[model samples]
Target: MSIPLLKYSLSTQNQRVDGYEVSPGEEQPRAYNTDNLPSSVEMDEVIWAAYRQIFSEHQILSSTSDSNLESQLRFNQIRIKDFIRGLVLSESFRKLNYDVNNNYRFVEICVQRILGRDVYNEREKLAWSVVIASKGLESFINMLLDSDEYEENFGDSIVPYQRRRIIAQRSKGEMPFNLKTPRYGADFKEKFGMPQFIWQGPVRQFRPQEQRPKAGDPALFLGMVNDLATV
Candidate 1:
């Protein structure tokens, strides 16, 4: 049997060393964050972009010059975005951000669905729900819009639907992981067969490489949505 050597800090530049090196350079280096954030906020953006694309595919965010679509995707988007921001700024993601294996896995399945690829398997469904548990309402919205498969299926017009679908999902019961042991980290392995690692302090004393956008900001958070509107 192949042993899944757990890679700590899989979301950051200075990922923990497993038996084998993960990938060359930062191209595929595992990401870890004291903040438990996924490496490359751009990946996170892809999640949101996929959500928007899927929502658009559903026509959940469509609007006429006169009236809005029957589905309320805008409200959903706002609530979900707020939820994601809150999760990122939470103690869990901040003090010792662990990898969101189940969350990421779930999003992958959802993205596939948006692309009209094979639907989510049973485990995949659980993974999708785990995303909601990790980041709450915001994840719901972002996952829908930021999926690459979604972009492949629904070209352009992803932004508006992203916002709308979020509202719809929320109404259907998607929120935070309310627990008495709030300090306990969410489980990634049991949920999605990913290796789990505790959030220790920063990886020794290694510093992260700095990256800057050339033209205009890459457009993060609400800015991304606004940029979408402009497009």
Candidate 2:
């Protein structure tokens, strides 16, 4: 069952949101995960096609070359879906897709891009929403990009595309992702990214210390309780 999250909170042992610990009330530096890892372009056509579909809303950066993107994929062994995820989450993508959208709506649009289909149901919708709320957008995107359903549909090599839209008698209407509607009206055009209701929930449980002792340390040999007692 999904928790009824009203707001989101970001807390860490380190002030850094990326993964760090610091004294409370002290500001921390942020960690960035957008490093350019080496990748390959042996299958350029397949890779490009995936990029087009997943990053349909994003324009290719003047600095981003086809070769660079190819290498990023091959070297990292990044799944087609994950590549799409990187694009969807990229600063370029966030500006276009996430701007002027709220949580429910943002989740719907991302699902369309990554899954190639509208969400199956509300339970599905809330599940993803809570994720975005709790972990922020990047983690939420990772969940869908790495889901079993996604793997089953697109696998590691195949690029993500729209899924089956017609269920014969069971469902109807065109795919929402294909609709020509604008993200919002003039009043809401200023809204950038999801609403607060989806991004401010408190962490369920906080583990302030993530570091473990060295392999041969007495703490390691003594186990967790003994180690903490000594500290």
Candidate 3:
């Protein structure tokens, strides 16, 4: 039997009770939605934006890009949400994210990428993990995408972004999810034998060697003079 999702308390930290205020020099996030895409160029930009958001910056290469999904989106066969779903369920995504991360860590990454926020707490992580264990990855992803939170923020047309990235009180907003959560988990790195520290030994100090000859070592010139005299 499939286990139902466990309830977890929502933390106030993730809640957007305060109004968004941008500092003078801060760059605001640009929202890319299907509503205003008028030309092929715009469509291409939107597609690229979706890839960047879902896969995180630098994670999506030409080889990793889903050509089928892109074609579907281009032909108007799928909405932005479906495109995102395709990406999350794609083979590349499975290898880069799911295969490398455990259920709990993968849950955390999905919440951040799809929901555009951190999991409320460990309990939330556990709750979603139960869904993954029961219904599997597709169901877990569907639940997140179909949630009221996602609908209110991104809906079917708009690409998901980090919500409420800038706060009025704090000097800096929260770190970008990609930077905060690495593509490879600790276990994956350890299993692959990726070195954590490049240089394990202490740095050695350089010392200059004395090049001048001493007075006691002057006999070397006399040997040459005696040889010359004998010749």
Number of the predicted model whose TM-score against the real structure is largest = 3
Candidate 1: lDDT over CA atoms? 0.36
Per-residue error (Å), model 1, residue 10: 22
* TM-scores for all predictions: 0.23, 0.52, 0.76
- Assess the local accuracy of residue 140 in candidate 3 as a C-alpha lDDT between 0 and 100: 93
Please give, for residues 1-231, the per-residue lDDT of candidate 2 as tens digits: 545433433232111213222443222211112233313343555565655565553444543334555567766666555666667777766765667666777787787767666655666667677878778888788777787867776666566655433331124544334443526633354464434444566668554566655567676666677768988
User: How far does residue 199 in candidate 2 sit from its true spot (Å)?
Assistant: 38
What is the C-alpha lDDT profile of model 1 across 74-139, one tens digit per residue?
A: 323333333333333334332322233444543443333333332234454455566567556355
- After superposition, the stretches of candidate 2 with alpha carbons farther than 4 Å from their true spots are 1-42, 57-67, 74-79, 165-182, 185-231
Candidates' C-alpha lDDT: 0.36, 0.57, 0.80
Tell me the tens digit of each residue's lDDT in model 3 across 1-231: 767778899877633676545553354457788886548999999988888888887577776798888888988899999999999888888788888888878998899889887788899999999899888889999999999999998999998876666542254556776556546777778879888967879999765556545577775488888989998
The runs of at least 3 residues in candidate 3 whose Cα sits more than 4 Å from the true structure, single-residue gaps closed, are 22-26, 168-174, 187-231
The order by descending TM-score is 3, 2, 1
